[model samples]
Target chain A: MDRRDFLKCSLAGCSLFLVGKGLSTPLSSSALAAPPSQLSRVEARYYQKLPDREIKCELCPRFCQLGDKERGFCGVRENQDGKYYTLVYGKVASLNVDPIEKKPFFHFLPGSEAFSLATAGCNLSCKFCQNWEISQMRPEQVRNIHLPPEAVVETAEKYNCPVIAYTYSEPVIFYEFMYDTCLLARRRGIKNVVVSAGYINPEPLADLMKVVEAIKIDLKAFTQDFYTNYVRGELQPVLKTIKQIAKSKTWLEIVYLVIPTLNDNPEDIRKMSRWLKAEIGPDYPIHFSRFHPMYLIKNLPPTPVSTLEKLREIALEEGLHYVYVGNVPGHPGEHTYCPNCGKVIIERYGYTIKKKELSGNKCRYCGQVIPGVWS
Target chain B: MKTSKVVVITARNVFSGQGLPDPRVVLKMFRKGLELLTGASKAEEALAIWFKPEDRVGIKINTIGRRLLSTLPETSITLGLWLGQTICREDNIIIWDRSNEELKDTGYKLSNTPGSLKIFGTDTRGAGYTEEPIVNRNIGSLFSRIQAELIDASISLAILKDHGLAGVTAGLKNYFGAIHNPNKYHDSHCNPYIAELFETDLIRRKHRLTILDALKVQYHRGPSYHPQWAENCKKLIFSTDPVAADAVGWKLIDELRARKGLPSLKEENREPVYLFTAEKLGLGQARLENIEIVEEEV
Candidate 1:
């Protein structure tokens, strides 16, 4: 439809609400709160101060060199008066208590709840972003709740959550706040898990690894072209992050959303699985989630369930042990089967643990030691 | 189909003694530029070509740079007044940016009087972004309701500055204020996204004209102001073809950089290549060969 006709319809929709107040004076809303402002005085590591007040943001592969008062590509970190500050530090836009299974960490404590939080702004602009309302906005543009580090730990304790999950939007954008919160949560014996696209530089990732317990990287696609066109980022750095996690003590899991025409080729899936087996070993779980048509990518339809099942078959055929399907509530692919005994060990139905046949960390049916952090 | 004509009008005394835009000269520049571009004998005739008496005209200004560098109040007010006198009523014209705070910082009175010209921001209480995303090409953004719903027509009255990424911040880049996520499109020097955004029905179909306020141009190291690199070019550019207008603005910046013995935008690896992308999409002519240059002194 034409914009004019659409606008006319919109105005007509609001006409009934306009009757309460005269159009002369606009209603007053509350003034914006600047308490958790962008004045994060925390000293940033992994950056070099250039000549003439410009600083290169080495926290990501983009390495955006910004001038005074300019923000980096993330829209969260800014160079204010020649220093970098993460704008979304302790500025939570969305917070909820979700099952650890929802983060899809089949290896971690299955039924436990993780206190999840996300802030405004992301490092990359994915065309099919499900959370674009918050992720692709400046901190000032969104309504943020001030949940500082201590409050975060307190909230987790209050909810009886054993873990704090940094999920929803990109956690790398709120690096400082997540780092500090991880430290606080760790001291309180609360485990920390990160659900990220894993688009970060090495030095900062190393620092983050020292605090968080488990990391779930959403490897968006296997190709650099897909990363360039859809995600507005580079694929190499994300691959680097996965390799880094494999080398570290942190439990690592990978999620790849299979968007039908975009990134769901069986050959590419086979290549990625083979690469993962060679580099990180086949123990790490890889979830090929279903992609919904969202944000700018509404022209295309969602990935077919059969396509996801086929891709799962390809990954398994390529010597990967733990391969699963996501976003489909009750498909048989959601269950974890023992590679040794071929029996269903963990049956999942939409983030809920329907059945568990594991005795401690070993398979109850076959007595094979499963490669997972099943406490 | 016939292509649109773009006019470039310059004035000698665009800057007043206090070292900002002189309102009187800016009005004259807008008048003559619009008149010549639209091929109208009078200023009112040019304005009547696009707008009607009952229209609510939105003057979308750029104020992200705050007070130090922004679309000066004088240029925007002069256009608002001219628009108020010609096609729309005074109250139907609104001068706006992203926020009331930025507007206040850039020296503007926040007004919403019934019969007077209204001035406010997109963040003004009831005026936030649209809940749904407008999906077009690779540009998916929640438009500010002020631009998408509040007004009937839009005038991109923007500052012409050398962008640190886009190479030029003129009329086309000004529409970034209308969308919620401009920071995301800054990659690859804002190539296809800038063009694709302008092609969106939210912007392209409603955009009536482009007026670039270039009285004091920040030619280099910009989008932010450094007084040392600023120059008083004292000019305003008008066009219906948005790409052509920005193309001229890019040339002007290159000229300034050359005069100062600095590198060209291409040499610096930040050229405004988005114009070519826009041209390839059939938005407008970006090359100098196709654009008919018109220079007038007001």
Candidate 2:
């Protein structure tokens, strides 16, 4: 049924106890507020139209040349009878009012709550995909709530959330949703943050940087071999994205999921840390998150706490400023430490921010100016 | 040593001038192929070796490419009817694939008649994939209810075509439809996954036959229809051994490719290595010499 009929049918609610367990509800006239036809109709900026109704999506490094009725590696976007269409435009699969620390964006807006939203589908088929229930599915396979761009901003404002986070499933798959949401959020004086896998192309990445406030890229692994064998993607594009985001006004942070044996190699971590320090400079926070066996890659054990700590030490030794360990609830590494004075600037436990030892942008302990969106 | 024979039967007039396949000729070819492959005097006797009269048989057809390049409805329906008439009850037969939409695209009329032949797909609301995963070797996927539940025995009635990734998609690769996630198995040129999926109990226990519809072989740039490469070879291959059947199908694709002055699949670096993997897993014979192919015109 269409949205209008569905709304009308919902309003004729009776006190049917058979529906039981407080199942039946009467919809107010305002509850049927036309369901908001909020579409993120931003013309995709990085696709080249080819002859015979084909188009090569330059949005990501996959460079998917799709024929009619075909989708890119990311199942959300489709070539509908020759025209390219993002099926997940404004299709919100999951939404939660999460603290900024939950996005593990420890450096960016440490204590503030962010309204996070995600649509189904992802570009890379990582065997150890955490959000496979949504990310690995087609847009139609998931239950989508109609939280369009305007509605998203309004919800954030309603919840007193300062930031709107495009997260959970890879935001790159729902590019149009996140992009337009960022634009709307920006107009409403709300910040926009994106959690991505950094698998996007330069052109789209450049366009995204214009509206979004911060972007946290999940660098799945350090080597190309791991990217290919495990993640079904390339590491070069991620590196390129890091370089591009570093130049942009958008605040950039990188999250490296330290999977045991697969990518927890100290040598690779050291090299990655050095690259981050050399290229993006030390201020950009690199998260060495713990990995649990998930999806297809369930054979290996989770990364040991020592391994994450060791990686964190390596990053710090490599002159990285804002390195953090994630997924370990009460670990000391979860807190953000000041680069100069080596004091806990922001204490965190899992998604919760316990304390902020910073006065404005500077650490209260040693008056060291920590580089992030501190207010 | 693996003891199995693959029979290939071809008929030039399998398709009438109206572009629809003559079901009678196709049925005759199927019978001939089965009889020769099993060294049975009659096709029904050969079928009796594997299938019981009470078995609910599912003829799994490839319909992803739609009518232009798919296992034609006429061919599948004919096989289903023949199996019903000669081997089992009409009500006990089901010609199926992944989705109803795809079945319709390939010109199949969906049926669930109580006392007549039925045609449906896994995406039939009540007949979705099995909720739990069946893990075997490199494969971990939820098999379609049509494959895992509804049918007692399975027949992979596939269309012979060149694949962009797997070199060739034939009888064994056709079982990709039996599982919910064919997309995941496409990695590594469908190496161990293809072989392993066939090893799953839902498939390996129930699968009885492999019949490749080589009536119109797409020699190159295929699995999708590119008219220039399509050839109406007018053939149907049948075998109890799934790997041997696909091995013969691969040889046919290679033969066509070679005739067109195209490089061998090995030279093109896209050979269907899954056959060898399947052979190693004891699914069937992958080596060309092990399969006794009997080619005949019906």
Candidate 3:
């Protein structure tokens, strides 16, 4: 089911049915009925114990130094009696089956279904977070289902989904859960992808790169000022994460949500495109997503369609190979054009693939090779 | 310019050998602190200044530290019951925190009986956070229904502690528990966010008093329980000006840290700059020169 249907079903206490390969099976309600108070006590991976029952979480850039019975800035990890633990280890706050295109990974398995899930909590507090209902809440604040790593992989297989996406919320905060699930999904022959704001520390990012196949990083802004005011994060670390992911074996895509008067400057987009070209080259696709009035940023109007079109043009001009406009259906910018042939290789309207001119991984018009995972 | 008045009340033998506070002595200290704070002859008269007979008063307590460093049950219950017996009805007084688990862990019995002092957390059924975020400058969060709708007035009965991030988590910072996403506000030593959160209409309009539960103060390495740095100062700080109350709490922590041969919060570069931000927002006086100190032994 879609995200809205899943939420409605979960809230109404209805039995969820898993549909796959023309067969449907009832998912046990008990699995999704874990008491809100029940949280995992798994010891966290990246943390150092300090004196007097204090611990410093090293997973994110925040490096939250917490005392006994205190939580990190993510609100999912807690330090209990000097031991750091991930409280949301198996707590799935949201689960959905969505088109891989919804993750906006234009070049990765286009039109394929993705088994997506997310735990509550996020490292960054973006002012316009679209999924604030789950991302900005603690594990206890949201309704959750206890889907362990094995169950997550099994459910992906049952749903005939080739890819498992750690999405909706920032996957970086749920690193332990995502990492473990990635390993399990890999062993089960299912691909694992992550959608995050990329506010992670280098050590954890390095380790995470080994397991996940693709990562979609939401590069919030180009300048540190926007990162500080609107995102409550540092721009340097996100840039570092993007550079790291590009160098790794994993596929990387960047999404820039163009909010009105906030990080929508064409100059900044040019600089960002230049930086990406200089550091990571032009192979990776970058989606300039339209920003809606969400969360704390409701005062501003929806990002003007012209703004998205203009930013996309700026990136394309900056030598980026793949630049697509998002959230605006039937826009010509939604199509993926072959950099060499300059022909539309993949055409789309919203999340659906209306027409594709790609022969395997090549452009059908000119037989030019396109960069993406096309299996 | 009138200086904000702050009262510090200390009682001898407030705690027994078991490290538990004496309820009777704690109640007496509250009486003296409230009376001295309002310059009233009686505690009831002092409470009447801020609360009415029909007002539903919410006592927001800091219980994240559980039993070790939380606002102790003896201290908060005595004050809560006293408020109930005075200006407000017993049933209308709610002594609450962020979660029922915290309240239970901190030695509080869950009580929501009518015509009696109600004790629960924001997570209690029918008492969750607001549906929409209450947005202020640099602050947007879902405030607890208790703070936003259930109560007409609020009193921050917060535990005085040395916070590693905020420098000092006192009366003003305690209201962080009232919001759902307090974790999101810890950036930059919780500076402008703390001040900005208090400036919100839900908090600034309803907040009536600030009471720092300083019977045992965490001088360093705190917001968590650290026995080595904890001090038994046997004090309760009271003020109508929330910023002035927290500023005084900050000074008391520095004094305790100094006696223990530790660096001051300012030296550590984590002194609560939020107090100054609050003062700039016209919340209260953050400077000692702008505050009138009234100390008493009960």
For each candidate, what is the lDDT? 0.83, 0.80, 0.88
The deviation in Å at residue A72 for candidate 1 is 2.2
DockQ of every candidate: 0.30, 0.17, 0.47
lDDT, candidate 3, residue B17?
A: 79
- State the TM-score, rounded to 2 decimals, of chain A in model 2: 0.88
Candidate 2 lDDT over residue span B31-61, tens digit each: 8987888788998998899899999999989
Screening candidate 3 with a backbone cut-off below 3 angstroms (N, C-alpha, C), the clashing residue pairs are: none
- Model 2 chain A poorest 10 in a row by lDDT: A27-36
Off by over 4 Å in 1: A1-45, A299-302, B1-6
Models ranked on DockQ: 3, 1, 2
Label model 3 with its docking quality class.
Answer: acceptable
lDDT of 2 by residue, A187-215 (tens): 88999999999999887888889998899
Model 2, residue A311: distance off in Å is 3.2
Stretches of candidate 3 off by over 4 Å are A1-37
DockQ of predicted model 1 = 0.30
Candidate 3, residue A295: the lDDT equals 87
| TM-score of the second chain, cand. 3 | 0.98
Winner on lDDT between 1 and 3 is 3
Which scores greater on lDDT, model 1 or model 2?
1
